[model samples]
Every structure is written in C-alpha cells, then in structure tokens.
Target: MLRTYKFRIEPTKEQREKINETLMYCRWLYNALLEQRITAYKRCGVSLTFYSQKKELPTLKKVCEEYKSVHSQVLQNVVERLDKTYQAFFRRLKQGEK
Candidate 1:
C-alpha cells in the first residue's frame, strides 16, 4: 500500500527570510554549475558529472561564505537534479523527440 500525508504551517518572518535566502543561494549555485558544465564542454569537450561538481562544494563553501548557510545535502540535491535533467534530455534526443 502507498500512503501520503500533507500538512501546512506558517513560518515566522525571520524564518521566511532565511528560507528565501536559501532558495536564492540554490538558484545561484544551479546557474553557476550549469554554466561551468557548458563552458567546460565547449572549451575542452569534457562533460561534467554530478559527482565531479558535488566534490567542489567544500571548496565553493570556502570561497563563498553564503553557500555555507545552505545545507550540504540540499546543494547536492541541486546537482543531482541537473544531472537527471541532462540524462533525460539526451535520452529524448536519442529517441528522436523534438
């Protein structure tokens, strides 16, 4: 059997601000990682993998203090999502889907 539950709650003003900040950081990281992958492939014909980019999180945190505010797992999840997107895109391309 499968089951699901849902609940909703209001966040305090400070909590809301913190959540928004984390989201902004995630968005920034996603865009930066995407650009890095595209540039690497264009310049050197190398495709960046999720594990490769995930390994850079610690160094990124060291260079950008803002990323430290976001949880490591959350950032890894962002990388994973992008990788999945790329995989699906290529799969569809191989299947001749427009």
Candidate 2:
C-alpha cells in the first residue's frame, strides 16, 4: 500500500530567508522559460519542450547567481510544472474554450 503524510513546521530566521530566496528563484525561472517558449513560437513557429528548457539550467546557473543557490531537481520540477501548464492551455484550445 501507498501512503502520504503532511506536516507543518516553523522555520528559523536563516532558513526562512533561504526558503524565500529559493521561491523567488523558482518564480523567476518559470517566468523566463514561459517567455522563451512564447517568443520561440511567435518568432520561429516552434514551441520549446521541457527537455530543451531543462538542458538550459546548467548554462543558466553559470551565468545567473539566483539559480546557483537552488537545487537542480527543484529547478527541473519548475520546468516540468510550466510544461504541464502549456499542455493544459493547448488542451483547452482544442476544446474550443477560447
């Protein structure tokens, strides 16, 4: 059988600072990837896939200090979440929602 559990705990001042910083990095990465995808499609008629964005992380970390503090898997998950959002958007388009 599979199970799940949830808990809430308070963070220390330093930990809270790190957590806030990580959240900001994640938000920035998501927005940047989304913009890349949009611009690629608009200018080149191509939509960027998750793997393409994921591959860019290493290079991004080298140039962007904000990404260096965040873990690799956390950044990968952000790319995946944005991909899911794009997929849902196209699905809605197919359904004639807008």
Candidate 3:
C-alpha cells in the first residue's frame, strides 16, 4: 500500500495574489509549450521540440521575483520545484523514458 502526504502554506493577501499569478503563468506557459509541440508534430511529424521553451522561462522568473517581493517563500519554492520537475520530465522524454 502507498501513503499520501499533504502540506499547507500560509500567505498574506499580496503573497496570495502573487502565488495565484505564478500558477496562472505556469499553466499558460505549459499549455503554450504543449500546443506548440503538438502543432509542430502535426506539421512535421515528430520534429516538434521544446528548446524554445527556455526563451519563455524569463517570464516565469519575473513572476517568481514578484512573488518573492511579497516574501512568498512557499510559493517560490513550489515554483522552483515545479520548474525542476518539468526539466526532469523533458529529460526523460528526450531519453525515450516514460
């Protein structure tokens, strides 16, 4: 059997807004990246790639900085972890691993 773990974070109103913006930005970027890849695939048959995704990362960093301004450490950490996780996922995909 497996166990589940959960955590909670407390943030001020300003921090909360920043965190929300961060989530929105992440979702937007992720969807945009996926759509770009998919469209490329449909056009070129697997020639799609995410290298340009890095170019858009500055937007995420800007949002992170905004959140950090509000001392939203928890949100910042979550964003960092998510960024790392995406990198690992992309790496695994590159390696042909699910």
Q: How many backbone overlaps does candidate 2 show?
A: 0
Q: Give the lowest summed-lDDT range of ten residues in model 2.
A: 60-69
Give the per-residue lDDT digits (tens) of candidate 2, residues 1-98: 99999999999999999999999989988998999999999999998999999999999999987688999999999999999999999999999997
lDDT of 3 by residue, 1-98 (tens): 99999989789999888778767755654565567666877988864333344554556557556433333344344445545666788899999998
Off by over 4 Å in 2: 1-6
Q: Comparing candidate 2 with candidate 3, which one achieves the higher TM-score?
A: 2
* Residue 77, model 2: Cα distance from true site in angstroms: 0.7
Which candidate gets the maximum lDDT versus the true structure? 1
Clashes of each: 0, 0, 0
- lDDT by residue (tens digit), candidate 1, 1-98: 99999999899999999999999999999999999999999999999999999999999999999999899999999999999999999999999997
**lDDT score of model 3?**
0.59
Compared to the true structure, candidate 1 yields what TM-score? 0.93
Best by TM-score: 1
Instruction: State the weakest 10-residue window (summed lDDT) of model 1.
Output: 61-70
Q: Predicted candidate 1: what Cα RMSD to the true structure?
A: 1.7
Q: List the residue pairs that clash in candidate 2.
A: none
lDDT, residue 60, candidate 3: 51
